[model samples]
Target: MTATAELVVDAGRRIAQDHPESPLAIAGLTVRYGDKPVLFGVDYATPPGAMLAIIGPNGAGKSTLIKAALGIVPKVTGEVTLFGRPQAQERHRIAYVPQRAGVDWDFPATVLDVVLMGLYREMGLWRFTGARHRKTALDCLERVGMRNFADRQIGQLSGGQQQRVFLARALAQDAELYVMDEPFAGVDAATERAIITVLKELNARGKTIICVHHDLATVAEYFTHVLIVNMHKIAEGPVAEAFTEANLQAAYGGRLSGAQVTRLAGASS
Candidate 1:
C-alpha cells in the first residue's frame, strides 16, 4: 500500500484499539474575543464515530468552541484534550473544514492544487508536490466524486462544488477526527445529501465528526449527538433527548417564537 493509505490504515487501527470514547474532551473551556467572553465554562465530550452537531443562534460561540478545542483560539481558562493528548500534540490526527465564506475563492488555484495542499504537513513547507502527491490528491477528489473536476479552477466552480473540494482536501489529510463549520450552507439538496453520505461513511470508518450546524430541520437525521449552546453550554446528549423545547428556549433566550420551537422539536423527534 502507498504511504498515504498506510497512514490511514494505521490511524484506523489506533482508533479501533483505543476506541476513544471521546475525540474531544473539554473541561471549563472558556474563550474571550478581546474583552467579550464567547464560550463560557463549556464542558463536553465528542465520542468516536459519532456525528455531533453544535447548534445555536448567531454569535452563540459554536464556532468558537470548535476553534478552542483545536487550539486555534486563545482560551481564558480550560483544558481540551484530543485522543487523550493536547490538541497540538495530536494535530496530525485531526482535520478541519471551515465555512466556505472563510476562504478566499478568488485565489488562482485549481481544485487539484487546493486538495494537494493537504499534503503540506507531510510534504513540508520547502518541498514540492510530486507524482505521489498528485495521485493522492486525485484519489481524494475521487472519494468526494470530484475527480473529473480536478483541473477546474476553484473560482469557476459553484458554491456546492467548492464545499466538496474543501471536504476532499480534509479527507486527503487522513485524519481521525473532523471538525466542520457550516458545511451545508449555500449548497443544493444534492450537495447536502452528498456531504451527509460522506460524513456517515467517515463515521462508519471510526472517525469522529463534529459540525457547527445552523439548520434546525435536519438535526435528528444528520446527527447522533447534539450540543445546544449560546454563550455557555445549554444542553448536550443524544439528539432525541438533548434537542428539546426547554433547551431551545435556554439557548435562544426566549427569543425563539413558539412556532419555531415547535418546529425544531418536531424535526428533532
Candidate 2:
C-alpha cells in the first residue's frame, strides 16, 4: 500500500480503538496545489451530534480541508475516517453541500430535479426515480420551506432560495453526517434564520454537522464546537473553550477585533 494508504489504515484502527464514536476524524491531512501546500498536517475529531463551525480567513484552506477529508479533492498525505471507517467505505453515511457560488445556477434542472439527485446513490446507477422518490424529494423541500419552488427552474430563484434548494437536496440524502462549505455566505437574514433552524433540528435528531463559516461573530452562537484554521489548525474544541480571542488572533493574525466580536454576537441575536 501507498504511504498515505498505510497512514489511513493506522489512523482508522487507532480511532476505532480510541474515539470509537467520533463521527469524523482527520489526521495528518495535507493538500497541495502543484508544489504550494495549502493544508499541512491538519487534525480534528468531531463528536456526533455537534454543530461544528470551521472558522478561518480567506485562503486559509477551510473549504480545502473539508474537500480533502471527503475525497472531493485529492490529499497529499492523510488519514480520514467517518464513524471509524474510511470515507470510501462510508460514503452513503455522509452528505456534502458545497459553496453556492460553485454551482452553475443556469443548469437546466428544476428545484425538484436537483433535490432528487440526492437520492441517486440509494437508487443506484441503473434504476429510475419513481413516485416514492418524488414524494421524498418534495418532503425534503418542505423542510427547507422550498416546496413551493419545487417546479421552478433553479436559475430563476433568488440566492437564498437557491441555497434552500441545495439544503433540501442535502436533507434528501438523509445522511448521518453533513459537511457544508459556507451555507451562510451571501444569504439574507430570513434565510440564515431558516437554515439555522433546520440545522438545529437535524442536530436534535442526532446528526453531526460541520459548516465552513466565515462570520466569526456568529461562531459562538451558531456552533457548539469550533475549528480555527489558517492553512493549518490553530485550535479546535468546544466553542466556549476554543473560540477565544487568543486563538482567533493566532488563526487570523490579529485581524479579528473587539468590535467585530461584539457585532457578530449582536448579529446572531
Candidate 3:
C-alpha cells in the first residue's frame, strides 16, 4: 500500500481503536476473482448510528466491499465483525437490500409477500404467519409508503416503487444495521426523496446505515459518513472531513475533471 493508499486500512481502524464494537468492523479484507484482485486489504469500521455512504467510480468494488463483509461473496483474506462478534452469530441483527435488478420480480409474489420474507427468519420458513406478523409487515410497508400497493404484484411496479418495497422489506427485519447496495440507483425524484427521508429518520433513531452509493452530489446531503475507495480505500470519515478534493481525485483517478471535482467538493462542503 502506498503512503496515500494506507488510508484504506488505517482510516477505518482510526474510527474505533478503543472500542472494536462498532456496528461493523472489517480488518485486512481482500477479495479476488481468480488471479484478479477486486479488493486489496481493505480495513473499515462503521461508526455507530452513522449513515455512511461508500462511494467510488465504476469497478471500484464498492458493492464488493459490502458483499464481502456480509459474506455474500467469498473473501480471500481478513476478518469481519458485526457488533464485536463474528458475522454469522450476529446476522439476525442485520438487514441487507441487494441491487434491485438482481431480484426475480416475476415470481408471482405480491408486495406484501416480499416484505413477509423478512420475517421468515424470525417466524421460521414453514411456520404460519399470524395476524401480528402480518401487521408488522404492513407497518413496514406503510413506513415506506407502499401499504396501498401491498396486494400488487412485485413485477408490475415501477423501478422506484420496487425499490421502495425492498426498503420496506429491510425495515421489516427491524435490524440494528442496514447494509444496502445502491439503494438510490435509477429511482425517480420522489422515490429518492422518500428513501432519503426514511433512511435519515432511521439514523435518528440509532440505526446504523452503510450504503454503497454512487452519486457524489448527494453524499453530504444524504449521509453523515463517507468512504471513498478504488480497490483500496481512499478516504473515510464524517462526510465533511473525508469527502474532499484530494480523496475524489485519488478514488476516481483521471475520470473526474477539474470542474467536476470542484463541483463535488463544493457540494460536499
Candidate 4:
C-alpha cells in the first residue's frame, strides 16, 4: 500500500476505536477484477444514527465499495466491522438493498413473497413462513405503500413500485443498519419522496443508513454524512463539512460539469 493508503487505514482504525459504537467500519478496503484494481485502499466509518451518502462519478467503485464491505464481492485486502464486531458475527443487524438494475425483475414471485424472504434470517433455515411472518411482511409493505400490491408479481410493477417493494423488504429485515445502492435511480418523483420519508423515519428511530447515491442534487437534502470516493477515500464527514466544491472536484476529477456543479451548489444551499 502507498503511504496515503496506509494513513487512510490507520485513520480508520483510530476512528473505529474512538467511536466504537459506529454501525459500520471499513479499513484498507481494496478490490480487484482480474488484474485491474477497482478500489485502492479505502477506509470509512459511519457514525451511529447517521444517513451517509457514498457518492462518486461513474466507475468510481462506489458500488464496489459497498459490495466489498458486505462480502458480496471478494476483496484484495480490507477489514469490515459492524457495530464493533466482525460483519459475519453481526450479519443479522445489517440490511442490504442492492441496485434495482442488479436484480432480475422478471422472477416469478409475489411482492409478499419477496418481502417475506427478509425474515429468513430470523426464521432459521428449517422454519417455514407462517402467519406471524406474513403479518410482518404485510406491515412492511404497508409502510412502503405497497400493501395493495402484495399479490402482484414482481415483474409487473413499475420501476418506482419495484423500488418500494425492495425498500419494504429491507424494512421487514428490521436491521439496525441499511446499505442501499442507487435506490433512487430510475424512480418516479413520488417514489423518491416516499423513500426519503421512510429513510428519514428510520434515521429518526436511530437506524443508520448508507446509500451509494448517484444524484448529487439530493445529497445534502437527504443525507447527514457524505463519503466521496474515486478509487480511494477522497473525503468523508458530515455533509456540510466534507461535501464541498473542492472535494467534489477532487473526487470527480474534473468530470463534474458546470451545470451539475451549479445544481449541487443550489441543492446544498
Candidate 5:
C-alpha cells in the first residue's frame, strides 16, 4: 500500500463520520446512446453538503449516469430528482462543470468571459453582463482562488487553471447541486488540492456535489459518498461502507483481477 493511498482512506473514513443523508435521488434511471443502451436501471443518492464520487471501469456508463441526471442525455426509463424536485424544474439550482478536455480552450475567450456565462440563465439572452453579473463572476473566481487570473486567456492557462476556471463558472451559477465530470483529470497536485478545498467549502455551504471520478486511489479521500457503477450501479452509500472490495469487484468485472485487487486492498487499508 502506498503512503498516499492510506492517508486518503483514513481521511474518507473521518469525513463519513461527519456527514450522513442523501440529498439527490435517482430511481431506475436508464440512458441510451442512439439505439444502444448505456445505463441500466441505475439508482443512487447523495447527501446534502456531501461529496459523491462515481467510479467504474472504462465504458461503464459513469458519464452517462451524470448526463442522464442532468437531462443532457436521452433516458429510456426512470427519474432523477434534485432536492425532491424534478431536475427539469430545478435547472437554475444545478451547476455542471464538464471535463476540461471536453471544452475548446482556443475558442478566443478569456477566463472571465467564460465564467460570466454562468449568469446567462439569469441575465437572459439579450441582456449584457451587468455590474451585478460581473461582481458575481469575480466573487466566484475569488472563491476558487483564481481572482488574479480572471482576465487571462483560457488557452494560456495550464490544465489545473482551466479546471479552476470551470469551477468558478459553476460557482457563479449559485446552484444548490453541482455535477462535475472528471475535475481532477491531468491536474497537478496543488491544483487537485485547491479544487478539493473549494469543493469542501461548497459542501459546507450546503451544496451537494457529484463528480465522475477516475482516480481510484483518491476516491475514498475526495468523496464522502461512493457510487460504484458499471452498466448498472453496484453499490451506493457512505464511502467507507459502499466502497468495499465486493462492490469494487462487481463494478470492475474481472478487470481488477487478482493482482490488482491485492494492490488496491493494500492501498485502501
Candidate 6:
C-alpha cells in the first residue's frame, strides 16, 4: 500500500485486497493524540466465528484500536467495515463490553437495570419494559451466574461480580459479534473461568469475539486468532501463525525470548 493509500482505504484506489466476509475489517486505521501517533496504518480483519485476542505491551494502543474501530475515539484516517459493510451501517449487529475500570460503578443502577439497558437497541429507549424484556434480561443474567444479584446495587458488587453483570448485559444484546476490553483483568480465578466458559460457548454458537487481552499466557488457550501490535501492525493471523517469537519480538522490541514466546502462545518456533 502506498503512503497516500495508508491514510485512506479507497476500495478503488488502495489495495484491492480486503476481507470481504470478515466480521470486522480495519482498513489502514490510524489515530493520533496531538503529534504523537497512537496507531499507525493498522490493517486487520476479524475472521468469522473467531475468538481473536489483541495482544501488545502497555501503551501499544490495543484499546485505542478497538475504540477507534467502534467509534469511541477519533481517527486520523481509515475506514472500518462490519460484515462486509460500513461500520456504522452494521453496528447494531455488534455488542461491546468496555473495561470494568472505566465504568461508573457508583451510579445508582441495579444489576438488572444494567442488563435491561442492552435491550434499547431492540426495544427503543422509550419502549416499555414489558414482562418479555424483563425475562430476556433475567435470562442473560442467569447465563453469567448473576441471577441472584439482579436487584443488587452495581456499586456494592465485587470486581468479579461487576464484570459478570457487564457480560450479562452484552449477552442481553444478543449480537452476532462481541468486542470486549480485558474481561479477565483483575478478576478472580473462578470468575475468569466462568467468563471464558461463557465466551467459548458463545464462540461455539458462531459469535465472532474480539477481545483486547494483556495476559500472554492465556492467549493460546482462549483464542483462535491473534493480532500483535506496537503503535502499528506487527503480526495477525491464527495463533500458530501470528503469535510466533519473531512476530512478538517485532511488537515487543526483542525483549521476549523464543522460549518465552513458545510458552506464552504455544508457538512452534
Which residue runs of candidate 3 sit more than 4 Å off their true CA positions? 1-18
lDDT of 3: 0.89
Across 9-53, the per-residue lDDT of candidate 6 in tens digits comes to: 664223214567788888778899898999987888788999999
lDDT of 2 at 235: 95
In candidate 5 the C-alpha lDDT for residue 246 amounts to 78
Any runs in candidate 2 off by more than 4 Å, and if so which? 1-17, 258-269
Q: What value of lDDT does candidate 6 attain over all alpha carbons?
A: 0.88
Q: Write the per-residue lDDT of candidate 3 for residues 163-206, one digit (tens) a residue.
A: 99999999999999999999999999999999999999999999
Candidate 6, poorest ten consecutive residues by summed lDDT: 9-18
Q: Indicate the worst ten consecutive residues by lDDT in candidate 3.
A: 10-19
Candidate 6 residue 130 C-alpha distance from true site, Å: 1.4
Q: Could you tell me the lDDT of residue 86 within candidate 5?
A: 63
Model 4 misses residue 10 by how many Å?
Answer: 7.0
lDDT of 4: 0.89
Q: Report the lDDT tens digits of candidate 1 across residue range 1-269.
A: 25644454444344433534577877767788998989876777777678999999999999999988888888876667788776788889888998899989989999999998888788976688899999999999998889999999899999999999999999999999999999999998888998999999999888889999999889989999998999888999999899998899888877789888988888877
Error of 2 at 70 (Å): 0.2
Better of 1 and 4 by TM-score: 4
Over 4 Å off, model 4? 1-15
Q: Please report the TM-score between candidate 2 and the true structure.
A: 0.92
lDDT, residue 7, model 3: 59
TM-score of candidate 1 on Cα atoms, chains taken together? 0.90
In candidate 4, what are the lDDT values of residues 233-266, reduced to their tens digit? 8999998888888888888877988667766856
- Per-model tally of clashing residue pairs: 0, 1, 0, 0, 2, 0
* Stronger candidate by TM-score (2 vs 6): 6
